[model samples]
Target chain A: MNEGAPAGAELLEVRGLSKFFGDVAAVERVSLDLARAETLGVVGESGSGKTTLARCILRAIDPDAGSVRFNSANGWTSLHSLKEKELVPLRREMQMIFQDPFSSLNPRMTVQQILEEPLLIHGERKRGKRVAAVREMLSRVQLGADALTRYPHAFSGGQRQRIGIARALMLRPSLVVCDESVSALDVSVQAQIINLLEDLQAELGLTYLFVAHDLAVVRHICDRVLVMHRGRVVETGTVEDVFERPRQDYTRLLLSAIPSPDPDVPLKPLDRATLNL
Target chain B: MTAPVLAIRDLAVEFKTDTGVTPALSGVSFDVPRGQVTAIVGESGSGKSVTANCVMRLVQPPGRITGGSIRFAPDAGDAFDVVKLADRDPRLYDLRGGHISMVFQEPMTALSPVHDIGGQVAEAILCHRDIGKEAARAEAAQMLERVGLDDMERRMGMYPFEFSGGMRQRVVIAMALVCHPEVLICDEPTTALDVTIQAEILTLIRSLQHELGNSVIFITHDLGVVAQIADHVVVMYQGRVLEIGTVRQVLKQPLHPYTRGLLQAIPGVVPPGERLATIASVVGDADIETPHPLVALADGRQVSLPPAQLRRVARS
Candidate 1:
């Protein structure tokens, strides 16, 4: 494995991954390898199977076919075939951050209870140790310990998202799947969260499966990006190659749709005839 | 410059919640020139929606307009004060759908699930136009076609639920424009849509604006959309105007620290390893004083910049 190169040793290998809902194939034969400490972005519009792929990888939803292998301390383990009881320990190595901060966290639970739930479920026996770990993780997310006693409703959207990030990092997972985590936030607040994510990744040496619909966001954070269209991977390349010199027409269309903030550069709307819809 | 079609001066709104009276908007003033788009850009809770609501006289009880005036001047009519009008006044009905119309963020909520699309649109025309049902329905179908809805004559009979997200939005636009209002207020109109759909809607709005020659008040948080559509831009933060200028001036040469921070904070423009500048980092613990001096650009665009910042820009 080359430490300096963009590609590192494979931390996760997903082969022939497929998920079907009724007659629709939400995800189809998706195969990819996530390098250790590398951020891989999956870009697609709604119904393109990006969310389905993330859920299948996390075992939140069962895939109809294919295997997900993770490189563990002991050896490689098949995540898809593992029984629910046996998969609990492996879950600590992989965690997810959801899209909506308002609904993701429990409204009834205090910040402490929300963050410590995973630890308690995973059998961390010492109460003092859990409190210490929770406090430390809160600081990592740039939140104060004073937030622990307060409910989710008390905090703003940005702060609630920070708590979500803190909860995901509680177990110190090597792989963090952020599923449109910053999409709902205001632009300024989104920037703050993105910066925090980058800082945390550097400090913790984390691998990220950054899934988003926004092309600009994917370009900013990912080393490599995969463009999915109609449940199929249309293009996969480095961020520069995918964004600057897209090989597929769909990718080009997606890129053009991104409204640039610069007033000097005007983008014409895609013509109906060109789309061939 | 031509006289503004609508002018908002020193507007103030307060929400009386259980905790206390929280001021949502204070001293917000702007003008909507004829045949141009003015975008009010802000983050959540920055009073953008409240300003729009005040224009339509839709601000409910517990959320009252404490001060200021909204002046409406139609092309060939006497000017009137919108703020002074009572909620139950008969004149408000004429102004709302006749002179001003609005499209909300969520199309599904704005439209009725039970009502057929054509009937609803026709009803809007009937409210102000004194037209017969047949003529109103014909105008509704024509408006739907104008908004680029396919098979408009048949699709008008279908309920809103039958339409996709993008299609539903088109229906909403058709209904809003059916009355042929002088001003259209679109609040985050494309926020819920996919990117391609957003582009299409934007194009539709631009083309419709050109064809109808109506002034537009575009409320959005995305600077990208503002850059694309707005002739003039107003940047708001925490219920106060940070800066207001022509699109080119504000986006190209932002002077206020908050405006500058917002421009730098967008992700795609920065490289992968580089950190994005944040608002908190730019304005730490210091409240920016209001009523900054307005600097006139070479192109006649006005930017609100503090004197110190203006001096710094001049030196640099």
Candidate 2:
């Protein structure tokens, strides 16, 4: 997200999005805007409905109420209003990357088959073109072409994640929803993947909804941060505003909980009792 | 200086697989001081867990301790050589739960799904102490409460599946500390938990260790966790101990090439938009650059070599 992004151009907009599982409200009337080529972070504890909110925006699972409007090449389109048949082409523009690279990717499939599958699903049937696209994506993700022949089990967790990224970027999606994508990796490998994500975003002008529990990662990658607590958005601001001067007690508690790598800064987690968490 | 509670010297472990022998730990050595948290930090397959398993005498089958001496120095009397002990040694049973215990990353694997929390914790107490069931249960209740689990009586009756991941980890800690083990091996205990839960657990473990005055061997890849809890740090890579010192010394002034690269490459520590310092992916011998006589930290005053990798070649 840089100078090329149109001023005040909105790529995706969610208005009062809500989802409930039986009696429980998984996501409660959440509203946010993702600018073109901007990376927005969603941070919260487990079971705080961040994942549900992401799913609703992507229409991976339908929201019970509210509307999701995405600015397609054709212009503004309501994602929820589109029928399943009409949603097919747009689905390519909105893709998702998962946390566990091991389980998300098919163990039986080679890297080639895995990357090519997405193109096939979107109706790109030419074998030569699919192979070429897959190779290009692989290089972009910093994985070599030799990796195409190996199974997921053959690669390390980091390498498998790179393959996963390559697969997600194969269709050149405009928006990518990364749900705890880098959380599972070690710090070093996590850095490598983050760098790759940043590079790919810069080159291809991709928008990312990076959902993670690590506040440091959110601060590092996202232009703005959204803090969620038990199915509601508690805070949303620029990374500096939320991290340095958080308005909500819940946001402050989450920020206080992050362990600084510096030894001099002792970890001081706020008491849950104080915030009534 | 007081003798260390655990002393590992020239530790070498290997697996006799179909492909051939693969060394897991070769000449890994470190001293874990008494009442201090010594963190063994390494990436995946760095043999941190293997070292823990070897110390616990839990390694089986093709996995073998080819060479080493793991000495457990009790507060009183003789220093027992752990590596020389037989598989069925009766003392291993006592030393395990009585003196040393482990809390793992996955709490589910440690806690039985069928067993009630109280019963499992009480069983551990009974295993090490000559106590009645009622007395053991009472002590178990205290342990559970100490681990930050409120409503211990009610939670004790619940099964593993009924509790959240963080709550279950507390139960695991309770069972591990039931016998009051002198050495606690926590292998990435907070790795699976969220940041808030991780902070709480780290605090709990630190407080418990402070209260009990017992030594802890915490194995993790997260440098931030090491900074949070460790008094002493041991940096390992590919089964070798590359650097060893107090946490301040290791983290603040890293001497090894790999350690330097690791510290600089972390995301949050460095300002955003700057490209992170990266170590070479292939890391057999880190003498990739021309050996300079010195290396710099923040100001490059210490010695001038490559800004990231070490200038000098030898640690010995």
Candidate 3:
């Protein structure tokens, strides 16, 4: 359990994180911090290494270099330095909502089985308690009890994502990395899931590492933004500061690329010549 | 009004399963103007892609075009009903890639992993035109460069896997346009790419459309894309055309409740939570009924709204 790390305290911290696959540096010297309850958007295009950075921080994959510090009820734990057995307890605090709802969830498993697995893994031996927790989480996501028997294949993209969120919350994790969670759903369904995410964050005081390619969704959901380019942080600032008055040309270029829904807002897309960065 | 480059009248398609028949498209109709982008916007099962598939005569087995006429009036060819021709007919063969080529969502599916980029581009040209290998290759290189894939001498020799997603998409665009098709059907062409890359691809398409003067039937669920490039908008819901109008008319003053719901659902269009269920309680029963005949406006725009919906818009 996160044993009272103080209100508004830093939940997670990373410094000079880097990972290399052969000659290519997927994430190079990336540093960031997350407050107790804040949504930080990690914005990038393909090959930008935002996903690799998140994976490294969560210890889903090992980072070649740098450090990670996480605060729990046991106080500050140096996560990068911890061994596998020692890290097991801390693993429950960090969970992930994946990009594809279809592939991320197993088609064979019922919603009850899917949601209850996390609790079972974290040593909730009592079957009734696990089911109750799953039920509670499902309701929080606006899916009722009747969904318990349904398979992932039976549900729509939006409902499947809700199940994914419920699965992520079974352990009541403090940090949930939403990796393009809403992007795959249809426009209307995307809005519903986003609103659900927002509501859950407020209710549970969750810290979010939102990695996405959609600028409009990022702008709406996130409080602060980190712009990544070619495995490096190009800019990190408040959403307004980065969006309205971006410093680097690359950041400006990313901003310029977002297609506005309003037709009257003339498209001044930066030329493909500028994509070399 | 001048005849549109393509007229889709009462388009209907059905997908038959062992259980029963599912009407993928029922009474869908719209007109695509000459040298302009007509965007068909809808959710997943809304039959937007079905409409596009029917146009190219690409709908496969079990999915049959039951009724409708896709009157394709190309720049130089005589107007013909695409539905009347068999899937493998000679006339249909000429129309499929030679005149109306399609760009799919996944470029990898269209492109061959084994073949060199130059070969694929040249193959597209050689299929439709009576040209030699070297001439086709030369034309392919020119087109590859035209779509902004530079260093063609080296890059053209590389396979589709060697290129990035955006680059592969550019090659797909180059292939679709190299044949000099009068009609380009882009079905969610940029849905898989990054926003920056998507923007770039969109710009390239718009610019080339201007240069070639080919009418484009852009099928996308993204209204932002529809707003960005579409001259006309076709809104669909549950396998039918909810409304049809210019981008201005459809987006600014949507005659259908579903269109309004979709537009409002775009992030930042409305407050977060409220936009979630906007479509649920909205869109009355009367508006969704079949037999919706398009009502023309003083402007070039048209809508298939019910009397109540039309009156509501008029008052607003």
Docking class of 3: medium
Instruction: Return the lDDT, model 2, position A85.
Output: 86
lDDT of 2 by residue, B1-316 (tens): 7999999988999989999999988877788899999999988888999999988988886999999899999776688989998778877888887889999999999899899999999999998889899999999999999898888769889999999999999999989988888899999999999888899999999999999999999999989999999998888777877777778877987777677878877777678665555555423365623433233244322332354444243332
lDDT, residue A157, model 1: 96
Expressed as tens digits, the lDDT of each residue in A254-277 for candidate 1 is 888889899887867566467773
**TM-score to native of every candidate shown:** 0.95, 0.93, 0.95
What TM-score would you give candidate 1 relative to the actual structure? 0.95
What lDDT tens digits, residue by residue, belong to model 1 across residues B281-304? 776654565666456555555555
Off by over 4 Å in 3: A1-9, A271-276, B271-278, B281-293, B314-316
For model 3, how does the per-residue alpha-carbon lDDT over B1-316 read when each residue is reduced to its tens digit? 5688788998989999988999998888788888899999999999988888888888998999999899988777689899998657888878878999999999999899999999999999988889899999999999999999888899989999988999999999999999999899999999999888888889999999999999999989888888899988888888888778888888898877778878887886754324344455355454465546667666656667777667666566
TM-score of chain A, every prediction, order shown: 0.95, 0.95, 0.95
Q: Which of candidates 1 and 3 is the stronger one according to lDDT?
A: 1
For all candidates, state DockQ relative to the true structure: 0.76, 0.66, 0.60
Model 1, position B55: C-alpha lDDT score: 92
DockQ (C-alpha) of model 3?
Answer: 0.60
